[model samples]
Target: MHAEGADAADDARAALLAATGAATLDDAVIIARGRPRLDGGEPAGPVWKVRSTRGLDQEVSRLAKSRGVSKSQILREAAAAYVEAS
Candidate 1:
């Protein structure tokens, strides 16, 4: 590779190493949970994606099934509860 290409590859490797200090996905989640809010300030609008693992998805599905509610309803209620609490 060219000298600039080599340097870019090294930088990318260093960034990935820094990002994955924890060895497991669960550890990464814990690290992520500890991070400060990334919004910089209050968000400008309401629409956003909420991320979760398969484990959480299964639990939410179970709750929805038992409660006779749709998955959307469960997710919406969860988001509403979080918004109200914060």
Candidate 2:
């Protein structure tokens, strides 16, 4: 079992090195450690939850689809613009 785990780790490290063009195992490890958590371990940044009408949600979704971006991206851009204009 330990050998299997080690092999999996080795495979992941090799794949990471290849994908990132890292020259060393240390570099690959650093890159892996730098990735943000997506499993609810810890957030990479501030997260906000807002309440909106269904119409607003649909509009945001429509805008996101038309702009070829995620709904979150649309909301983030809108927030940034509001801040800049303030």
lDDT of each: 0.65, 0.74
Poorly placed runs, candidate 1 (over 4 Å): 1-49
Q: Could you give candidate 2's per-residue lDDT for residues 9-33 as a string of tens digits? A: 8898889878655668776566446
Clash statistics: count for each candidate: 0, 0
lDDT of 2: 0.74
Q: Residue-wise lDDT of candidate 1 within 11-74, one digit each (tens)?
A: 8656554564544445544544553433576554465578889999999988765554456667
Query: Which runs in model 2 stand beyond 4 Å of their true positions?
Result: 1-43
Query: Which pairs clash in the backbone of model 2?
Result: none
Backbone clash total, candidate 1: 0
The C-alpha TM-scores of every prediction are: 0.42, 0.49
Best by the TM-score measure:
2
